[model samples]
Target chain A: MSVKLAGELQSGNVIIVENNPVVVLKAQYNKSGRNSAVVKVRMKNLMTERISEAIYKADEKLEGVMLERKDCTYSYYAAPMQVFVDSEFNPYEIHEETLADITKYLIPDMTDVCEVTFYEGRPISVLLPKTIIREVEYTEPVVRGDTSGKITKTAVLKHTKHELQVSGFVEIGDKIEIDTETGDFKKRIA
Target chain B: MRRWDLFCRVVDNYGDIGICWRLARQLADHDGEGEIHVRLWVDDLESFAKLCPAIAPRSPVQAVGSVEVCHWSTNFPSVDPADVVIEAFACELPLTYIAAMARRPTPPVWINLEYLSAEDWVEDCHLLPSPHPTSPLKKYFFFPGFTSRTGGLLRERDLMSTRVAFDAAAEAVFWQSIGIPPRGNEDLRVSLFCYENSAVPEFLQSCVEGPTPIRVLTAPGAATEQVSRWLGRGLVTGELVRVGALAVHAIPFLSQDDYDWLLWSCDVNFVRGEDSFVRAQWAQRPFVWQIYPQDKDAHFVKLGAFLSRFLHGVSEPTVISDCWQAWNGRGRISFAWPNYVANLAEIRRYGEVWACQLDHAEDLANNLIRFVREQV
Candidate 1:
């Protein structure tokens, strides 16, 4: 059975291949002049984490990759890692390497659902939000009439309980969103 | 082989005309089966003459190496119809030329040579064809890019050998001849040629404060003036200054070959816009790029895309990315120079590797021959 789902595909969505679920690591739309469009995707094995690339023809009918995302609350750390509880009260402990890049976005006692990529009931990779709200620590004074647009100043970021200064265009107390994948400021949250 | 007429309108710079002139020369010199005759039509002969020096301004058409240089003016020339026509950088071809191409027995190949980019989409769009609405001519989009799948970089045949044989002592003598003395010990020699930038103050500050000494060589422009204003003193005509540990040297304007030598001889080259940036890659040195700023911040996306590809295999990719971003952001120079200095060895290795990779790609002249042959 085949189904088509139309939305921006998030990284780590699990697709069935040879009756097994494979986790996607990246997805980008490939477009060309008068040529058929394709979703150029790279995926990693859920168990092995080995990456592979695949192209899905745009007009072709393909099986829909279904994934499950749940809202969860962070709980106490479980030695060398952190644990969280889903809405169904299921506890999931993730390794330090699994949450390596996005750990800075995590805040204890905060309730947010981690979208887990599942393949026949096994957890794969995690997909983080496009932007994360963080408080800025320091910024240089903005100058006037110098809008030649060729220079960037560095700024620091300070969370409520921790401080991590990043080099970017930001000001003190500005709630900026950081791309979990690229670790860049996406936008300033209103 | 298709006979192509490449039209170059020099926008008061040698770089633009220099590139087109080189391409035209390459096309004419091709030894393949099909004959390719290129008529290089240039608006500014004066600027072009500076690069070649042998170009006779009085002659309507003169042979320079292999290509025939035509003095393009308000009035178009009555010439044999070419099999292909190229409008460099979207420069409009003369109406007479356009009409001639339209009336040719077999419509000529029309191409709009686009600016180079490392963006993901460029690969997909490169060489895609567009039909002229009125004329039978079909125009192809030729994009100069860093990949095998795209039109390759503008490289001369002897470029690498020439760069290798370029005498350092001779270059020092040339600098002295142009009224700039040899750099002092502990000086970070820098060459600056760019559009007016607001980041000049911060860049100057960084140069003045960095652990290493800096000797900045500027082209004749507002960038020199900006440096002068920042120092609170007009550049002392012939002497270097001790601004902290940095020694800033202001040099005179250089010819194209001299500029290439400057790039080859410097610790860091801050190049603005197109031509010099490409040359810096050939220089095989660590560099900071100042992209031509766009109205809607589109250049930011272009800059980021390039950085993403350039730093793909680099050690301390984050630092390189940070330095590039800081260089292009709003007057922020705190991060780049310090981080870059700390990672000099790694950066230099990456530069060397990148230059070798670029060398494997076919040069502009050879690429033009192949492109024309396929189209014809």
Candidate 2:
């Protein structure tokens, strides 16, 4: 399949650029008076694991690349490598750098199922669960007279040590659900 | 010397040809050691002739002023691409011509000129490159906007100076030639041009019952038809329809320069679309814009965004904002007319200041030439 016009381009789509498969990470589209629009994208090179930027006419067609996915469970992290085991007990090790932004949300020693994407027999990327429950490690007390949740404060996840912006009322040791893609706090479990 | 090819598709209106003609004229008239060559290919010569009278509607090729006007035909012609190829309004170039472009040792600098908008996001996307998915070519996106970060509005070299030196005697002669009598201070003059909207009937009623009398100079188009229907009478060119204090004159469409003078002479202006909207702003008068409505009220967002920037820091914005809103069918002009008329002085002065501020930004034609020079 092919995507024509950069205006329709979105993140998570795999597009072939110069014969190399690149995963779109971010796409920004701009339209002028009455002319053709433009799309600027930040992509990850699946072949070499390098990051690159491309800008193109929003209407230019791009050949798309399809990836195979396998359901896998995260086992543990060994220094710079994170290991996951598939249903058939095959172990796949992904480098910390290869994990890109998803490494911050991976729960070590947990059995959470993840979707591993493969391009030509090599694991290219991993998709985490939509929402994950975690314990808050630390957060400052809400300001006096500011009881509204509209104002947010930063808090850390206990096991992952990843920073998450939560409502003002969020306290230390609170169990909250977070969205992995948006990094937004979804709801409080406890 | 750089040669430029500007391709335009009429898209049911004369605006596409209007902007392209202006840019072509500007580039072809540039005074440089190496004169620039401009070849303009328009799909609809009839629409082009409406804005530019020099064009012979039936001719396949004609020398119209500084540029060579080519009546774009269905059959592709074998020709070499110019140093710069502009896809105006996203109307794609001929595949055969593009194939020719790719075969050249150094491909042309292709630029896709996008629509105009004041939204902050335009700045970030301006000048971004889109490479041909298969062909070894890259095209840049040029966005025309009010801010310095984006390509500026289209303004000719001597437009302001010519306006400054305009003779009042000549203006009076022009008015007589257009069949409109001289205006008195008490009789507020107005030029009406707009798209069809449901709110026009109420607007005409407000004008008829208003405190002061107004003489409206209207061109023959959707606006004239609407007003004729409201009065239950037929209106022909050079005829006037009078009811109570409102008098609507059916005037023929003037040429571009004459249209500018019309905007200048009027105390207030009602303009539409991208070309005349920008011209009205530069005319430095209190004007109302009837945005080309889009599906799902998308144009309202564009109207509101422009108003937010145009009315920034003004002490009172309701009279002007409400009037514009009413003109766009978001509100009622009849309800906002009294206050709008009362605050005309303030709005007129603010318009001048806004125009002055916009004049400081780089003009579109100049910016385009600079970009071309860099590429070629």
Top-DockQ candidate index: 2
Query: For each candidate, what's the DockQ?
Result: 0.02, 0.43
Name the docking class for model 1: incorrect
Off by over 4 Å in 1: A1-190, B1-3, B12-15, B29-36, B50-52, B56-60, B170-174, B232-242
Writing each residue's lDDT as its tens digit, candidate 2 over A113-188 gives: 7998777777766788888788899889855665677888899988778898898888899989888878899877
Find the 10 residues in a row with the least total lDDT in model 2 chain B: B125-134
In model 1, the clashing pairs are: A151-B329, A151-B330, A151-B331, A152-B329, A152-B332, B188-B213
Clashes of 1: 6
lDDT of 2 by residue, B198-266 (tens): 888998899999987888888778888988898898788899877888988989978888899999888
Index of the highest-lDDT prediction: 2
